[model samples]
Every structure is written in C-alpha cells, then in structure tokens.
Target: MPKPATENLIEFLSNIPFFSEVTKSSLKHLTTVLERETFRKNKLVFEKGSVGEYMYIILSGSVKVHEKNHVFGHMHAGECFGEYALIDSNKRSASITTLEETHVLKIYREHFFQLISNDIGFSQGILSVLIKRHRNIDIIQENLASSKKALELANSKLSGLIDGAMDAIIMFDEKFRILLTNPSASVLFENNDVIQRNLLLFLDESSANRIQNLIKNDLNNDQPLSSNYLPDVIKVIGSHETETLNEGTISKWGDNVTSFYTLILRNIQDRLQAEDKIEFLTSQTEYLKEEIKELTSDHGIIAEDKSMKKVLQLVNKVASTNATVLINGETGTGKELVARAIHQLSDRKDKPLIRINCGAIPTNLIESELFGHEKGAFTGATATRKGRFLLADKGTIFLDEIGELPLELQPKLLRVIQEGEFDPVGSSETIKVDVRIIAATHRDLLQHVQDKKFREDLFYRLNVFPITVPPLRDRGNDICLIADHMIAEFSRELNRPINQLSKEDKAALINYNWPGNVRELQNLIERAIIISQNNSISWQSIIPQGGIEQEATTLQTSNTIYTAPELIEIEKANIERALKRTKWKISGENGAAKLLKLPPTTLASRIKALGIERPI
Candidate 1:
C-alpha cells in the first residue's frame, strides 16, 4: 500500500505556491491522493523526445535542467516542471535528471489534469505558467533561427567573455572533450581546440590521460562519489598557475550522464558591466559606485587631435591671467580635470583652490556655502565659519554645477565677482578679497542666460576662456597608454602583477565607444583587477554587458529567448540571490565568506571593495 499522508501535513501543502490559492480541503484531498517517489542520480525524471508523463514537486533535493545544447539551468525544491510537456504534449523540451538521490512528490498526469480541470483557479494558474514557459522557449527558438553565422559570431563573442572569467568555465563533452575554456583555460589545454577530439586522442598519454580516466570513472557511477574522483567546483584568484575546486555541486547529464554543471562559470563579466552602467547613471546610488579608478591625471583629459589642441592652447593662455574660465563638455569627458588643470597652472596655485558644486549643494544652503557666516546667522548656525569664497580668497574657486544656482544667487555671485565684497547672513560686517572663479557645467549656460536663468554679467565674467575636454572615442594610441597605466594600477591594487592586456582585451577596450568616458574605463579595470587571476589581465575580465556583449545579447531575454545573454542575466540574478542569502557580508561563519572558503576578512573586503549591491 502507498504510504499514509504522513503527519497530517496538508496544512503545509496549503501554504505551498502550487496549493496556496486553492481551498484547504482541496489541498488535503490532493496530498492524500498523491504518490511520493524517490529518484537516484542518473535516473531520468524526464528525457528529451520522451512522452509527457507526471509533473513533480521537488519537496527536497534538486534536479538538473539540460537543454539541447547542454545544462542551461537548475531547478530546486518547490519549483514545478514537466508541466510544459504535460499541457502541450510536445516532445520533452529539455531533459531533467536527479543531481543526487532525491526524494520528490510526484503527481501523475491523470490526477494533475483532473485537479486542474476540476478547479478553475488552479487550472488557469497552471495554464498561465505553461504559457509563459512556452512563450519563453519560442522566443529562444526564433532567435536561434534568425541567422547562421550571426549566431556563431554572437556565441564566439560570448565565449570570448570567459577569458579571465573569475568563475572557472569548463566545456566538457559527455565523453572527454574539453569544449569550454576560460582565459585561464588555455593554461592546461594550451590550445582550446584540444577539446575537439577526446582528451586521450589529443594528448600524448600523460596528464590528459590521467584526467580523462578520472573523469570517465567518476561520472559513470550511479552516485557522484563526492569524496572520491568526482569533479568539483573551481575558484580563480588571478594567478596564472593556481587552480582550485570551488564550492557548490557539479552534476552530470547527456545520454550516458557524462556531462556536468558547475557554479564557477557565472556570467559576472557581462553582468558587472550592466551593474556599472546602472550604478553610474544613478549618482546617488553611492553604495556601489561606478567611477572607475582614473588611470592618471593626464589620461583622456586633453585631446590629441589638432581641433582639440586648439581648445587646450586657449585654456593655457588664460591660465596665468586672473580672468575666470568656463569649462564645458559632455558628462564624463574629463571636464572636471580641465578645471583642476586651469587652477594648477594659475598664479593662485599656491593658495587653496576651493571646489564647490553649486548644483549638488542643496537649494536652502547655496548662499551659506558661497559666503562666510557669523554665529547665530540662522537656525542651525552653531558657530562662525568661512564660506568657500572666503576659503578661496587670494586663490581660485571652482564652481562646479554652476547652472544649478538659483536666480537669487547668480546676481550675488556676479556682485562678488565685480566688487570683491559680500556680507554674510544676519551680519553687517563685510569682507573684501580677491578670488578668481572657474565655473564648469555640462548644461549650456548661454541657454540659461537667454532664459534669464543665469546672470549675464556673471556669464560674461566667467566665460573669458573656455576649455573643452575630448571624449574617449576621439583619443588615439592614448587608449593603450591609458590601458597600460590601468594594468599597473589594478595589478598593484589586486596584488596581482598583470603586465599586459591579452590581445582581445586591448582590442575590445580600444574599439568600443566608452559612453562613461574615462570613468567607464576605470570602473571596468577596477572590476577586472578585483577578479582577475592572470599575471596579465584577460579580455574576459573586462567585457561588459553594455558594450559588445549587449550588442549580441541585449534583446535576448525580453520578448525573445537569446540564450547566452539570458543565461548570463540569470547568473547575475543568482549572484544577487547568493549575496542576499549571505546578507551582503561575503565573509564570516554564516556568510558567503565561509561558503566561498575564503577568509572572512578577504570576502568582506572584496564585497566592500568591489561594490556588489545585493538585490534585496
């Protein structure tokens, strides 16, 4: 006889998503009538081209989800599957097998259909779920059918992303062909095509043979011998020679069960790029910043083109003069650096060069920051203090975000510039001093002046000389020069002495248009440095989702099923899940620090230093 409904636990079923919205009595009846089945490793829960059978609720353990290409995803407890085949009657879209000897709650097709047909809400919900899955698969299929060479080029580009992949990437056949490779993958194989033929066939019967034998024996068994010769996970720390087995389970599949899935090959490279773009755009999202470590004060500040050189000559001509300078450029084009340079080259370089963001400063306090104040000047005035102008007396004051200044303050600024005198709030005493102002704004101040939003006198005074910084796209070999500088900076910061970018890394950085400008370059390098394991940085470490990766996989997930990008996106999601589960603390006994098997301090520092914002 079938086992009794143990512990009268229909209440537990009532809370499960599959049963949550259903009536409690219905849940009880379903549970009482269900069969509990156990499956062992290598057992096919369902197979490709197989008939529609039962749908399973994984009360415990997990199953591997393998598409035609390979293991595309994994399914864990409480998630339902086989519903696709059950409802559609199509061939099993993907083959699923037990990752371990797992116990599952199996609902036969007849009973499942009966329950669905009997309950309107339950039946509709199940149909909705199937529709979504079917639509997703259809989108993916359409994308694959879109082209031939285009798909390969896209996939090759995606594979190029794995060169310095922090997570170890392995592409192995059910037999012994090592198809997948990381930047470091070449370390052992020397040539990636080494995986084309069987390992024994390609090698001269030494290390490859030994590894092949080990792989063959372990995967052939019914149960994964975790303590024995089973293939484990891999973690990389930027060294050319260090190899490791990372945490998380690696299970096998394919007709004979020779294929395996790993946690090491996360799509972090593309995802990190996406995160940087999102983070960079949202300036206040400061917890995870995207301002890549600038290579040098000189990098990308001045353009080499003659047209750009004309602008620089103008900046230098007014550098020694006391006249105010207005600097303008697209955001992220190093306008701020030009402002600094103007101050450095000026006569007042010896004194303080006070930098204040007129826009960033709150509207309520714009006046207080620009003019010195006495005690009891306002409600929160705790003490007398010198404002930025007072601090910048006998020197230069850089007024960034000048366009954001209210109309009320523009005239006062113009007065201060013309008269060299101003009184603080609630005080009659006036201080007089000589200060040259350098104002920089991404906004068109002239347009503001036209709208009477900016003071014309102030504009005329500040626009005496102008400097326009060039974007990265216009820079020449300076690209490699900057890249070289980044190599040194990142290598030292990461404590890994990466001497050069792989040919691919150099090419991608040079060809791609850096919308974030020098800032984007710096962020990419910072991320690569944090995760890079090579003596030299690899192309894989720096490929981001926004650049070429997006061009290839950007639309892969939405209404379409672009597999690689979609999978990478999913990987990014899982990392967020892991970080959330670990509470953003990558280290410590209960943290990812312990699970990654890294020192708590190391993991904590990495989390902090890398700016990983958990998806909570």
Candidate 2:
C-alpha cells in the first residue's frame, strides 16, 4: 500500500539536489544508510567549531545558521549542513539551530563518501554546493570588514567622551571583567592596570556582586539604572583613602551582540560627615541635661535623723545587688530621690535611669508608654517608638506611683520584673533586657490587693525588698537640717541674704504638725527667704496657720519652752498617742506611721529620739 514506505523514501532521496540523476537502485542503497531525526523550535543542530562526522539534510521545517552571536543564513526543507564532512573531517565554521519543529535525515561521513564514489552525478552535486558556499562566505567577510570599521569609529568617540568625564567611569563585560577605565576611575582605584580584574576584588563581595548584577540587568533591558547609594564606609583595594557615602549608576552602551556596561560614581563624603557631626551634638545636649539633673538631685536627700539614717543604710546594702526595691512613703517624701540614690550607687550607674509616673499617663496610652509600639500599631502611632523599659536596658527603671498602674496591665509589669523580658504593644517579638527595678508609691498596695483593685501576685513581686522613706515631721532634728539646706539653696537661687532661723521660729516649726511633709517645709522656707529683707529669718515670717498664736499661748502656760527635757516629754506624748492608735504594732500596714501620717522609718526615729519603749 502506498508503494511500501522504504520505496517511497528511496524515491524522495533520488529527487534531492545531492542525489538527483543518480540511479534509483543506488538511491535505494543510500536511503537504507540514512538515519532520520527530528528537532523542535530553537534547538541546536550543531555548534560552531564542533567536529562534524555526519551531514544532515532537513526533511521539514526550517533552520538558522549563525556565526558567534550574529545570524547570517537560513535553510528550509531538503537543505543540508555539514556537507564538508562527506569529503574530509573538519570543524563546522558556523552553528546551525532550528527555527521551528524540524525533521532531518542524517548521512554518516563514511556512508556519504561511499554513495558519492558510486555515483558521478552525486559527487558533482556535492562540489557545486561547496563552491556556492565558498562564494557566500566571501561576501559575508566583506560585510564584516565594513561593520568592524564603523564599530571602531564609534568606540573612538565613546572613549574620548569617557576620558573627558570628571566623575569616575568604568566599562565592564557581562562576566564583571573590567574592559576600560577613564582617568578619574584610574585615580579612584589607585591603579592603572585594572583591565581583566574582577570588580569583586575592589569592594565587598556582596556589594560587588550587587553592582555586577545591576549592570548586567541594565544591559539586558537596554535601560538606564537609578543611582545606588553606598554606606558610610567602603573599602577599596590599594587605596589610602576609603570611600564614604558614594553613589553610582550603570548604563548599556556599544553593540547588541557583545553587550558592554558603563558605571558612573559620585562622592558625597563631605555632606555625610557634616550630618554625623550634627547627630553627635544632639546626643551630647541630651546627655548634658541628665548630668545636670544627677548633680543637683544628689545633694537634696539628708539623713541626720535615726529613722532616715536606717533607710540610708538599707539603701547602701541593696544598691550592691540586683534586687527589686519597693519604696514605701508619702507622695512628697523624696521617694524618687531615694530611687536615684540606689541607681547611682549600683553597678549599672553609668547607664540611664528611666523614670515613668504610672499615674501621669492616660489609661489608653499606658501600654505603649511602658512597652513601646510599632508603627501603625494604633491610630496616632506614626512611627516605631522605644519605651522606658527598653531605654533602661543594663540600668534601672523607676516606676513611680506604681499603685496607680491599671490592674489589667499588672500581669505584664510583673512578668517584666520577674523575667526581665517583655513584648512590645502590637509586636510579636519578645525583647529581653538586663535591668534593676525600683518602684515607689504612696498608696496602701496590700489594702488595694485585699480590695481586688490591685493584683496580689504583682504586689508580692514588687514588695521583694521594701524600703520606707521617713516623713519630715517624725525625722525630729533632721527637719532643721533640711530647713537650713533649703534656705541656703533658695538664698543662692534668689540672690538674698536670709541666712539664720530664730529660736522661736525653730520651736514653732518643731511644735506644728507638718501635714504636707518635706515638700511643704521646703515651700515655706523658700517663701520666707524670698519675703525677708534682713539677714535673719523671723518666726513671724514663716508661721503656719496658727503657729505664732499657739507659740505665745504655750510660752505663757509653761515656764520653759526651749528646755530639752520638756521637748522630749512632749515628743514622747505624741509617740504614745500614735502607738495607742495603731495598737502598738511598729512597722507594718496600719502601723503607728500610718495612723500618725508619718513614714514608718521616720516614726521609728521619733520613738527612739523621744526615749519611748513599747509597754509590756
């Protein structure tokens, strides 16, 4: 049927240009040795300069012939390539690739020669094809010569333009091998013989590879690249000066077949250095404020009374350790000052002491204030921020008015104090820190815990090492010491001559109940100093609501108002009243200090100063 497939193939072979006029019997023998093959679109039939051992005849579709990256010729069905292999072994002069799905008949070198020797017409046809190919090659050589001249002229102009450029310019190939460099580039590199050296040698591997890929992509896309800004420091090989804040751009140039890239670089070193100096100055200004605060605050706390002395002694012992401190006292009893004192005496004294008043921040913003937040964590959070706990890393954090902290957030606070780690608001990552905690509050935390207003677990965690600050009234003679210190400070500040306090003034201060503690005493002393025109401070100038009238009545009623024995007896009577009110418990919740509105330490000092002991 259909004259049998072999006979059909023989008939087809006899009609081809190489086998035309050969006897059908010889064509049939040739067909028997012919091997059939097929190739898809864009498939390589043979590469240039490869050893060719077989000639291929296209049976269907089309193929392209290319020399290097340039396409020069095309062939369709019934056309052959590697024809020189039939005569003698030789490398292919050009590469042949499929343009579309193609079927080919392959004739091995030995078999092709056998058929050519047996048929004179077949040999003539092979010679005719070879002659035509030689002529075509001559024409192609002429065209290539003309193109080479044009390319030379273009390269000359490009080189002249590059030499004139003030910015550093360099040309490189796809493999990142240097091709040419301008005078500016040579100076920047500190070397004249840079040709063939890889760019990776001059800069860091990552940056060099990035620049190479950037240039390669630009060349492939035939587009200009945006300038890439470098960091503060870039190391250069064989150069005395290191590059700073350098920027560069890459662009494609020259022939399409052999792509070449050019890079232009600019220096912004001076501008970057100026910006760095401004940043340093801003940080220094902030540091100066902290230093001034520390210097001034260190002088304010006095410990002349036995109660205050004991508190100071405990502070010294606790400052050497990383224990949590819970300072218990009235609002104006220098609780924060004591916290600062502990920080200043600790191992982490050089680091920052972050202070946050829990009562001062709004309820909604307290979480962000304590643990920081990422940008867009909530509305109005325009940028990422670091909280007080983060800023106090390797230092101390003073949580003032801790009793005012919201109960909902007490668990997080407790975790941070116990584990030294916390998650920021709206962030998944946990931040760990090395910090000492010092918390202060005037409210009764134990009572709040019992009332369910504060967390009991958090209260127990915070009360690890409690230190009570003494009130000014129960501090006894220390009141006069604090008065003189405040008067001297205010005199220097106000430029006044009020230096000494009268005996009646001192006695009136000792007898009157100080409702507002040390803060009130400091305020009174400052006012008296500001109003007085003379060198001496009078009792009339600083008399509380009824101090002068009461002093006069007491002086008329008693024989001696300034005697030490009578003053001790009066102090003992006051101590006895406070003890009776508290049921004689010395230092705990509902103790004498709570009843008398005094710090437990200050109340203890008053009992010792007055020589009053607990009755059996």
Candidate 3:
C-alpha cells in the first residue's frame, strides 16, 4: 500500500526548502504545474540579461552560476535557481549552465504567483526560501569581492613576469575576446588596439576553429587548467593583414570567482626560412656530389669517330634552345651520356639533370615515380613526395627507355611536354614545371605506334628533334679511343698501373659486334684492368677463348644472300648457340644475354617468340 505517484511527488516537494511550510494541497498543486526538462553538460539553462519567466529546481546533476564568462558559484541537485524571476519579472542576473547531464523541474512565474495568492503557507514558504537565498547571495558577493581583490594582487605580480617574457602573451575570456596583452603581444600584432577584440579575428579560420574546439573540449571535460603548446605553427594575420607564422601555448587559470585563458606565442617565420635555405643547400650539395662522381667515372664524351662527332654537334646545336630531344639507340649505346651532354651544355647546366629509367621502374609505380604522390594517396604512402619532374624544375629531366612508359600514363606525359603541367598521383591539383625533357629508348617508337602499343600523338610530340646514337660496333675506330680512355681511368681507380690496350686487344675490340654497345665495352675494360698483369691487357684475358674470333669468322664467312625468314632463322640459331654456351643463363656478367650484347628482357622475348626453351 504505497502512496500514489501524485502523493509521493507532493511529499517530495514538501521536503524542499521552497515548499517546507506549504500545505499538502498546495504542494500537490505545485507538482501539477512543474515542468521537467533535461539539459546536456555545458548546455545553457539561461543566459545573463535574458528574460526570465521561470524558476528552475535541479532534480539531478549540477550546474554553475556564471556572469560574463566568470564562474561565481555552483548549484547542485535539490537546489533552485532563477528564483528572483518568479518573484519579480527581471532579466536574469547570472547565467546557469549545466555542469553535467541535468534534469530540472521549472515552475512558471504565473503559477508561482497564483500559488502565493491562494495559499498563505505557500507564500510563507516562498518568502522563507527567498530570504535564505538572499542571505547566501550576500555572503557569496562578499566572498567574491575578497577573491577579486586577491586576484588583482596576483595578476599585478603575474603582469611583471608576463610583460618581461620575450614571447607575446595574451589573456582571453571564454568568448575568445582579448582581455589583456603584454607589450610583446602589441609588438607581435603590430597594433596596440588588440584588446577587447576577438582573438579569432587575428587567426585564420582553421586555426580559429581548432583553438575554439580545444578550449571548449577542455572546459566541458572539467579538465585541470594547465598550459600546453599547440602541435603546429599557426598562421596569424597581423596589422594591415600581414601574415606571419607563430608557435604558441594556451593555458587556462582561474580564481574561485573568475576563469581566464593565456596565450604565449613566438614568431617562427625567420627560423623556418633559414631552415628551408639550409635544406636547399643540403640538396644542392648532394646533387653536386653525384655530378662529381659521374665526371670522375666517365671523362665527358670521347667522340673521335665522325658519327659520334656528328651526334655531339647536334647536341650542341639543340643545347641552347628549349626543345624536346628524342634520342634513338640500342640499349647501352651512350643515350644517357648524350642526354647528360645536352644538359651540361645548356643554360640549365647549373641546375639539375635528373635521370630516370622508365623501363627499370615497376609498371605500377612508374607514374608516381615520375609525377609524385600526396600523403595517404595509397597504401603505405605516409608522406608527400616530390616527383622527378618536379625536382627537375627549371632544369632537365632525362627519361631513359621512354618507349616502355605505360600506355595509361602516356597522355599525362604528353600533357607535360605540350602544356608543361601535370597532376600528381591521387591529386587533382596540377603542378607546372619549367623542365626540359630529353627522352631516349632502344625500341623503335614509330613501330610501337604502328602496332598500337604507343600513342601516335605522344610519339610525334616526343620526336620533335630526333638524334640517333650509333652503336659501339658502328662507332668504328672510336672503340680504340674509348678503350684507351677507360684503361687510363680504371688504371687510376684500381691502382693497377695498366695504361695501354695491346694492338691485338684493340683489333679484337673493333672486330667484335658489340650488341650491348658502349656499356659492355666499359665493363670489359674495367674487368681487363682489374685482372691485367705486367701493366698490359691482352684480348685473350678479357674474352672467352676464341669466342670473339669465332663470331668474327662466322660474320666474315657469311656471304650467301638470305630472305627475311632465313635471316630470322640464322639470328635464332645464333642466340640458341650463345644460350647453350652459357648453360641457358640469360642475364648478369657471364650470362648468354650479356655475351650476345642484348638486354635480358629483349633476349627473353626473342627466346619466347622463337619457341626456345631450356632442355630438361
């Protein structure tokens, strides 16, 4: 036999200080008019200066009484606020904000007046509660006055430290309105009139939002007030809209009656600029180191033969102009060397000569390698990277094996050549670079276009000024000239003291068909120098026994005219012989592919097409 819900509510209301002297009937009537409302933490129940029509009693949780961003006192469950509103209609003197998720019961001023007029006990109960609240408010005002005095003294002492600090310091209220600033802050902002202005007015939108959210989160969580440095540099707009980068810390502090935030900031523009300069210098130093290494290894171009001299002449002719040069040659036939020569002789010689082998890079990554990618563009792409084309800005980019560039990426490459701009991987923003492109490839691009493997438009664009480099076999007497130079270079490197190639070695080198071209010759000379005895390199020591002579004899002895099909058969037979000699190995120093002076990929393709397979 429990009481009904209405009776229980009436009993509960009677226990409250506001209803303690009220009659049971008046208390029951009061419960009928009481409206229940729930508020989230940090939600405003009522604002100072707003019209107050209801007095609210907290049913659960707590709230803070504040005025103009200053927390004066706290009200807990079973306590009431806005009581003055029920008595005499006036604007709220203080704001009530929930400290946690709160439930409150509010009574309308009309209902309160009606209750007071009809019931003497109800009126007496209301009078008693108002008198008690008035006394408590007087005590609280006295305590606030004393706290304000102490706070002023503390601020006076803190002002000295804040003013003396080199970093700009500013104090702000909850609304981000500047309350105080030190001399350094005025100097930093380049304005003495920053006080009372919103701090967000001086910051960019992103920075402003970030700071607002940070402060609001801290306040809502009731976290301990402490100073901590912001994670990144913020862009600040100073007087006359001048922008500057600044790093700073924000701190929250309060006396019992009021809370405030302080900002400590330092300008980092000059430091960042100096760091950028240092980084640039470091990058330039590394580039110079690579250039020096290249110079030491190969002493420029040794072009004694007419064909090579003609190629150098073309390089010199086009070097001064900003023209796209297409170099056509077999693999290892000094195409990259010609590209380097073009870059060195041009005005961009002082800049970089960035080189990338298009065929060497994986098909999946070739696009990113050439055009770069944004951070998080793909899996494991943790940071933004500048591409080869971007790095070659105002310089030259040598794209070796251009024929192998993927068909999907060809249009982008064409755009760079035509419009001087491209978009990076996973980015819509287009980047323009004033880079001169020099493309080289062993494969016939025209054939590729005809076969629909390469775009005709892109091929035509790249073939603007074509230069053909003769293979090492066709370079004629340049072999001896290059050999002598390499011998001298390698002699110094290995400390072998071998300075000359024997007459027989020179003859054999000239007679051999260097399918791998200059690269193979360079490797041979270096190996010969490494194993040379008595300051002399013999043809026998470098080549397998009678291998060069047998190949030379076969070529010299072949006088029969052959059809296209017969020629293909002969070429296939020759490759099969070489592969068998090398035990079917296709790559590396002693591999048949290297011996035949062909790229392993090219040899593998030929083997597959010729239906050649390793014997079990």
Candidate 4:
C-alpha cells in the first residue's frame, strides 16, 4: 500500500532493534520523523562536552568515537551513536567524527521520545537497548580508568628518571625546535627559557653545522628511528658566551610525518680542566720553587725584635686555620714572606701556593689573570688558560696588592670568597675552587674604601685575620740583625772578604731611618760589599757626611716617633673619625667597620677595648 521508496525506508526501520518489536503501522510513521544528513570525511559531527540533542544512526559510512587525540571505537553502517540523547539531555560522553564521507539518519530527542511513548512495544525495545549500552559504558569506563592510571604511573617514573639524571637530556622536533628539557639540560645550557627555542642557538658554529649534517644524512639515507653515538665531542655555547665540551648521543623517533629527536649530553669541562690543571700546577710549582730559592734567605725570615716576634706569633696562630689573612704593611717589608709562612704551615701546605700581584698586572688583563678566560674570549686569547684561582685549588692564593683590585671586579672576588665560586671572564659557566686566600697590601685600604676606590665588602671579607708586619724602622734592633745577615750573604756572593760590620757602621745603621725597609738594607749591604777596599767597609763613604743628621731632622719634622700608648691612642682616634663619618654605623657597605677596613666583629671588639661609644 506504500510507495516504493517509502517501503524501503520502512524495511530499514524494521530491521533496527528499537523498531523490531513495533507494529507495521509504527514503522511507517517513524520514517516521517527521521532526517537524513551527509558529512565529509574527517568532519566533526559532535564534540565531547557539547549538549546532546539528537541521536544518529550510520546509514552508509563509518564514524569514529574519540576523546582528545585518542580514538576508542568506530561504528560502521547500521550502527547507532548519541543514543543516550533519546533517554536524557546530558552532554555527549565522546566526540564523533566522520571516518569517511558518510550518510546518517538523525532523530531529534523530542521526536524520539514521542515514538517511544506512543507505542508500548517500541518503548520496551528501546529500554532493552539502553540497558545493554549502559552495561557496555560501565565496562568501558572501568577499562579507561585503569589505562589512565597505568599511563600516569609510567609517565611519572619516566619523568623522575630523566630529571634525576646527571647528564643533560633534551627532546626536539625535526625543525630542531626544543620540545622538552630536564633540569640538567637547563644548567648545562645556562638558560631556563630553552623550550620552543632552536637547538642550534646553544651550539658553536662548527657544532651546529655538524649536527645539521648528521640529521640530514640520517634522513636522506632513510635510516630507521634509532640512536647514533657521536664519536667526537661537541662545543656548546652558554648564555654567557662560554664554550664547553660535551659528549653525547642523538636518537630519532616517531613516524615519517612527525619526527622527534632526543639528545643526551654529558659535560666534560671539569675533566679537561683537571688534566690541564695538573700540568699547569707542576710547572708553576717548579717556577715558584726557583723563585723562593732566589728571594728568601737560607735561615728563612730573620726576626728578633718584639714587634716582629709578635707578628710571627700571630702568623703561627692563624696559619693552621683556613681564615683569610690580610697582611697590612709597607712595601719591601716581607709581606710575601709572611704569606709564604702561612701557606707552608697550613693544612694545605702540600698544595701549590699561587701568588698574583693585583697592581702589577694591567687593568684590562687583571680579570683574566685572576679568574681566567676561554679561547677567543677577546683578542689575543688564542688558547684557553686557567687563572691563578684555578691553579691554586686546594691551596693558598696570595693576592698581593689586593687594594689595587679594580672596583668593577671586586664583586667577583667577593663571590669567590663568600661562595667559593666564580665565572671565568667571557664565560657563563661557574667554576668552584677550594683555595685559601691570603691578601697583602701596602695601601691604607680603610682610606681607599672611604675614597670609594675599593669595595667595602671585599675589605671585610679579606680582613678575617689581620697581621700587620712592622716596618724596618718600627722593628727596633731587627734592622742590625737583618743587616749583618745580608752583609754576610752579599759578601759571599760578591766574593768580598768583608765578614763583619764595624761599631761605627752599626751605629750609623741604627740611627738612620731606612725608609726602604729590609730591602734597602740588603741593597746597601750588597753595594757596600761590591765597593769595599782592603777587606774593610767604610760607613763614612756610604752614609755621606750629613745623611744621618738629615734623616734625624726629617724624622723629627714628620713626628714619626710614637710610644706604644701613643700609637694605641692614634688608632682609637682614627676609628672614631671613621665611625663619625659613617654616622656610627658598624656594619654593611656604608658602615664604620668597612671604612676602617675591618670585619664587623673585629671592629666591635676594638670599640669595646678602646671604650668608644656613639653620641648620647
């Protein structure tokens, strides 16, 4: 009784489970409410979390049910999707996408409910399908939860292993864009913002070129996704433009459409430095030994005066400790001798004692001389060289003339003292050393701090144990002893028969203020020995006629004579002046302690000893 096309539609509806129990009359009525829709392949039918308003049945092609990028199931022709919409108006549990160009019959929720309510048989049949789908959904949810939990556990373990690795691990795409990086990789590159950046940005030109070639060769050869070890080391440049040698492997993964690469690297900078350090220290030690033999007397430091004995006592007390010593004295007063004594007595005596004169080096090169530089860091930096700090690792470094250290570079020295770490000039990587520091200076560092020529913090850091070497004039009778010792040595060296100094010679030497300290006495003795006649030294010839009187007059005019009590008063006054200048601040950059070039604790002790106090 129906048209041919209508009869075909009725037959299709009759075969479906929902309408199988319905009467022939109901099947004919269902065709009127069903709407036919067509979709292109890969077209989105409905997205997860969207409102569900219609139920669809595949009529010609297949459709995929997925969440995010993972496909869970597929439905071919004669299969139904969005069936839950007929029972309730909840959000879609899964997204539907056409796997191919497909035709589908869609029924609105209102029409679907009307057909179920109008016919009891159809309603029973629909309920049966709903119960079965519910059971299937429960099973799928349990399996999905188990799979999600397993995936999370696996990912966590992998992440922990990668993060805990000491070697740097990085992941990148075919274009060399960074996809992920571990903490070690971040530290090696010296950059935290490496993600989404090009890998070539962190490598030197040669390394970048080589890496590109390697990748191209592998791709061109159609090699399978596998790892390949790089035999040669690669040079990586850090954020500070410092270069380091890294050894590692590169691996490729993923299909042809989307390729990924993983780079695993280990930094070998420390190992290379260790090898170079041994050679450098061996040479440096031999050179220093020769220098020591030439400069020092056979009997070592000759001291007899009470002041010199006290200086030696202080040196002995502090030599055992790793405390930084600041030897304050005039030039030619044997400050280097005191430094050598400390190093020779310390626990680190077995290690090298490296000395660097801050003022002796040029201003432009002093930084490199202290912290070192990489090759090509600047003009003339042809080969990488270790600085004095690196060479003095586990040893003592005597920073002579520390007051002359440039103000800009003081912070780096402070970092080394405070943190035991420093970055070489023109390098980003930080190098750590376990070197003890012993600084010496003839300049008044306190005055230098007030003049803003030196860093206050650095002064405090270096002044941990202050040892003031008495000048030649202040050492009392030590001058005569040193003179006699020098005279014997110089006489022997010059092949002169002058064995001793006369009473008059001793008298003149004692009376005259030797402004040049022990060094001047040595020189005078050497000259006297060279020009002596008849195996006798003449004091009159060397002293000139009025030299002693003139020196006495000069000393008197300069008011240089001070007793122990007078000297103490003078020191107290100087500290008070600095305190008042700094508004009685005892610590910090602008504090009185810094102005006086003393540690805060030392300054406080002195203030207490001197009974000095702030204004009421």
The models' CA-based lDDT, in order, is 0.64, 0.76, 0.81, 0.82
How many backbone clashes can be found in candidate 3? 1
Best by TM-score, which number?
3
Q: Write the per-residue lDDT of candidate 1 for residues 1-616, one digit (tens) a residue.
A: 6545553456556655555555655666577557889899867887788887677778778889886558978888767677654456678877888888888877777777788777676666555656776898999888777876688888888877876465455656656555655765455434545445553443343434544555567666634433332243223332233333233233444555345432233324445567656643342232112112211333435355665677678878888998878888655556667777777888888876667666544578879878857789998999766677876778888887678789888878888888999888768988897998888876788999999888888888888777766677677555666767866866766688765666766677777776556665665576566654556445542455343343223332344433435644664555556677866644336866456554332333234324455453
Ranking by lDDT: 4, 3, 2, 1
Give the TM-score of each candidate: 0.41, 0.51, 0.62, 0.49
Query: Per-residue alpha-carbon lDDT of model 4 for 319-387, expressed as tens digits?
Result: 999999999987668888899999999999999888877764568999998998989999999988778
lDDT of 4 at 206: 85
Q: What TM-score does prediction 4 earn?
A: 0.49
Candidate 2 residue 119 Cα shift, in angstroms, is 36
| lDDT of candidate model 4 versus the reference | 0.82
Clashes of each: 14, 0, 1, 0
- Name every residue pair that clashes in candidate 2: none
Query: What are the clashing pairs of model 4?
Result: none
Stretches of candidate 4 exceeding 4 Å from the true structure: 1-212, 215-278, 282-299, 548-616
- 10 residues in a row with least lDDT, candidate 4: 547-556
Candidate 2 vs 4: which has more TM-score: 2
